[model samples]
Target: MIRTLIGALGGLVVALLILGVLATFGVWDSIGRVASILGGLVLGMVFGQLGIFIAVWRE
Candidate 1:
Protein backbone atom coordinates (compact mmCIF):
# COMPACT_ATOMS: atom_id res chain seq x y z
CA MET A 1 0.00 0.00 0.00
CA ILE A 2 2.75 2.38 0.87
CA ARG A 3 4.59 1.55 -2.31
CA THR A 4 1.47 2.14 -4.36
CA LEU A 5 0.93 5.50 -2.73
CA ILE A 6 4.53 6.47 -3.37
CA GLY A 7 4.23 5.36 -6.97
CA ALA A 8 1.16 7.54 -7.39
CA LEU A 9 2.97 10.54 -5.97
CA GLY A 10 5.87 9.91 -8.31
CA GLY A 11 3.48 9.63 -11.23
CA LEU A 12 1.92 12.97 -10.36
CA VAL A 13 5.35 14.58 -10.25
CA VAL A 14 6.20 13.11 -13.63
CA ALA A 15 2.91 14.33 -15.08
CA LEU A 16 3.64 17.85 -13.86
CA LEU A 17 7.10 17.69 -15.36
CA ILE A 18 5.78 16.58 -18.72
CA LEU A 19 3.15 19.28 -18.68
CA GLY A 20 5.80 21.84 -17.90
CA VAL A 21 7.89 20.72 -20.83
CA LEU A 22 4.91 20.85 -23.18
CA ALA A 23 4.05 24.35 -22.08
CA THR A 24 7.64 25.46 -22.40
CA PHE A 25 7.95 24.11 -25.94
CA GLY A 26 4.53 25.44 -27.06
CA VAL A 27 3.51 21.95 -27.98
CA TRP A 28 0.09 20.30 -27.80
CA ASP A 29 -1.40 23.72 -27.31
CA SER A 30 -5.05 22.84 -26.91
CA ILE A 31 -7.36 22.29 -23.97
CA GLY A 32 -8.68 18.99 -25.26
CA ARG A 33 -5.21 17.63 -25.95
CA VAL A 34 -4.02 18.67 -22.54
CA ALA A 35 -6.99 16.97 -20.96
CA SER A 36 -6.30 13.86 -22.97
CA ILE A 37 -2.68 13.82 -21.92
CA LEU A 38 -3.67 14.21 -18.31
CA GLY A 39 -6.18 11.41 -18.64
CA GLY A 40 -3.58 9.14 -20.16
CA LEU A 41 -1.13 9.99 -17.43
CA VAL A 42 -3.68 9.05 -14.79
CA LEU A 43 -4.54 5.83 -16.58
CA GLY A 44 -0.89 4.91 -16.94
CA MET A 45 -0.32 5.48 -13.26
CA VAL A 46 -3.23 3.23 -12.35
CA PHE A 47 -2.00 0.43 -14.56
CA GLY A 48 1.53 0.90 -13.32
CA GLN A 49 0.39 0.58 -9.73
CA LEU A 50 -1.58 -2.53 -10.57
CA GLY A 51 1.49 -4.07 -12.12
CA ILE A 52 3.59 -3.17 -9.12
CA PHE A 53 1.10 -4.71 -6.75
CA ILE A 54 1.03 -7.88 -8.79
CA ALA A 55 4.80 -8.09 -8.82
CA VAL A 56 5.05 -7.52 -5.09
CA TRP A 57 2.39 -10.08 -4.40
CA ARG A 58 4.12 -12.66 -6.53
CA GLU A 59 7.42 -12.17 -4.78
Candidate 2:
Protein backbone atom coordinates (compact mmCIF):
# COMPACT_ATOMS: atom_id res chain seq x y z
CA MET A 1 0.00 0.00 0.00
CA ILE A 2 2.78 2.38 0.90
CA ARG A 3 4.64 1.56 -2.27
CA THR A 4 1.53 2.15 -4.32
CA LEU A 5 1.06 5.55 -2.67
CA ILE A 6 4.68 6.45 -3.33
CA GLY A 7 4.48 5.37 -6.93
CA ALA A 8 1.31 7.33 -7.49
CA LEU A 9 2.80 10.46 -5.97
CA GLY A 10 5.92 10.07 -8.05
CA GLY A 11 3.87 9.65 -11.19
CA LEU A 12 1.87 12.75 -10.39
CA VAL A 13 5.06 14.73 -9.82
CA VAL A 14 6.48 13.58 -13.13
CA ALA A 15 3.29 14.42 -14.97
CA LEU A 16 3.17 17.92 -13.48
CA LEU A 17 6.83 18.41 -14.27
CA ILE A 18 6.32 17.48 -17.90
CA LEU A 19 3.31 19.70 -18.20
CA GLY A 20 5.16 22.58 -16.60
CA VAL A 21 8.13 22.17 -18.89
CA LEU A 22 5.90 22.02 -21.95
CA ALA A 23 4.02 25.12 -20.88
CA THR A 24 7.27 26.91 -20.16
CA PHE A 25 8.59 26.04 -23.62
CA GLY A 26 5.41 27.42 -25.30
CA VAL A 27 4.15 24.01 -26.42
CA TRP A 28 1.03 23.93 -24.29
CA ASP A 29 0.58 27.67 -24.69
CA SER A 30 0.19 27.20 -28.41
CA ILE A 31 -2.70 24.83 -27.77
CA GLY A 32 -4.63 27.65 -26.06
CA ARG A 33 -3.56 27.97 -22.40
CA VAL A 34 -6.94 27.64 -20.72
CA ALA A 35 -8.14 24.99 -23.15
CA SER A 36 -5.19 22.75 -22.40
CA ILE A 37 -5.95 22.84 -18.70
CA LEU A 38 -9.62 22.16 -19.26
CA GLY A 39 -8.92 19.34 -21.68
CA GLY A 40 -6.36 17.75 -19.40
CA LEU A 41 -8.77 17.83 -16.47
CA VAL A 42 -11.60 16.29 -18.45
CA LEU A 43 -9.45 13.60 -20.02
CA GLY A 44 -7.84 12.76 -16.71
CA MET A 45 -11.20 12.34 -15.03
CA VAL A 46 -12.58 10.21 -17.84
CA PHE A 47 -9.56 7.93 -17.96
CA GLY A 48 -9.45 7.63 -14.16
CA GLN A 49 -13.07 6.54 -14.05
CA LEU A 50 -12.47 4.11 -16.88
CA GLY A 51 -9.67 2.50 -14.88
CA ILE A 52 -11.93 2.23 -11.86
CA PHE A 53 -14.66 0.67 -13.96
CA ILE A 54 -12.30 -1.94 -15.34
CA ALA A 55 -10.94 -2.73 -11.90
CA VAL A 56 -14.43 -3.26 -10.55
CA TRP A 57 -15.40 -5.44 -13.47
CA ARG A 58 -12.35 -7.64 -13.05
CA GLU A 59 -13.19 -8.36 -9.42
Candidate 3:
Protein backbone atom coordinates (compact mmCIF):
# COMPACT_ATOMS: atom_id res chain seq x y z
CA MET A 1 0.00 0.00 0.00
CA ILE A 2 2.83 2.40 0.77
CA ARG A 3 4.48 1.52 -2.49
CA THR A 4 1.25 2.17 -4.31
CA LEU A 5 0.89 5.57 -2.70
CA ILE A 6 4.47 6.52 -3.51
CA GLY A 7 4.06 5.35 -7.07
CA ALA A 8 0.91 7.37 -7.54
CA LEU A 9 2.55 10.47 -6.13
CA GLY A 10 5.51 9.98 -8.39
CA GLY A 11 3.23 9.62 -11.36
CA LEU A 12 1.39 12.79 -10.46
CA VAL A 13 4.69 14.62 -10.23
CA VAL A 14 5.68 13.37 -13.65
CA ALA A 15 2.36 14.44 -15.11
CA LEU A 16 2.78 17.88 -13.61
CA LEU A 17 6.28 18.10 -14.97
CA ILE A 18 5.10 17.28 -18.48
CA LEU A 19 2.30 19.79 -18.21
CA GLY A 20 4.80 22.37 -17.08
CA VAL A 21 6.92 21.74 -20.12
CA LEU A 22 3.92 22.06 -22.40
CA ALA A 23 2.94 25.24 -20.71
CA THR A 24 6.46 26.55 -21.19
CA PHE A 25 6.09 25.90 -24.93
CA GLY A 26 2.74 27.71 -24.94
CA VAL A 27 0.82 24.57 -25.94
CA TRP A 28 -1.86 25.43 -23.43
CA ASP A 29 -2.66 28.65 -25.24
CA SER A 30 -3.48 26.84 -28.47
CA ILE A 31 -5.31 23.93 -26.89
CA GLY A 32 -7.70 25.90 -24.66
CA ARG A 33 -8.49 25.24 -20.99
CA VAL A 34 -10.87 22.29 -21.29
CA ALA A 35 -8.68 20.37 -23.70
CA SER A 36 -5.59 21.00 -21.62
CA ILE A 37 -7.34 19.72 -18.50
CA LEU A 38 -8.55 16.61 -20.29
CA GLY A 39 -5.07 15.99 -21.60
CA GLY A 40 -3.64 16.31 -18.10
CA LEU A 41 -6.22 13.88 -16.73
CA VAL A 42 -5.36 11.34 -19.42
CA LEU A 43 -1.66 11.74 -18.79
CA GLY A 44 -2.14 11.40 -15.04
CA MET A 45 -4.10 8.17 -15.35
CA VAL A 46 -1.72 6.61 -17.85
CA PHE A 47 1.39 7.48 -15.91
CA GLY A 48 -0.25 6.54 -12.63
CA GLN A 49 -1.11 3.09 -13.95
CA LEU A 50 2.37 2.64 -15.35
CA GLY A 51 3.87 3.62 -12.01
CA ILE A 52 1.63 1.22 -10.16
CA PHE A 53 2.53 -1.58 -12.54
CA ILE A 54 6.22 -0.96 -12.07
CA ALA A 55 5.91 -0.80 -8.31
CA VAL A 56 4.00 -4.05 -8.12
CA TRP A 57 6.35 -5.73 -10.55
CA ARG A 58 9.30 -4.85 -8.37
CA GLU A 59 7.77 -6.64 -5.41
Alpha-carbon TM-score of each model against the true structure: 0.56, 0.49, 0.50
Question: lDDT of candidate 2 vs native?
Answer: 0.62
Candidate 3 per-residue lDDT over residues 1-59, each given as its tens digit: 56666666676777678767777888865546745675678677767777777777888
Q: How close is candidate 1 to the true structure, as a TM-score?
A: 0.56
Poorest stretch of ten by lDDT in candidate 1:
23-32
Which ten contiguous residues of candidate 2 have the minimum total lDDT? 1-10
Tens digits of lDDT, candidate 1, 14-41: 8788777877787754846996879797
TM-score of candidate 2 versus the correct structure, residues matched by position:
0.49
> Per model, how many backbone clashes are there?
0, 0, 0
Q: 1 or 2, which is superior by lDDT?
A: 1
- Where model 1 places Cα greater than 4 Å from the true spot, the runs are 28-31, 43-59
Model 3, runs deviating above 4 Å: 30-59
Predicted model with the maximum lDDT: 1
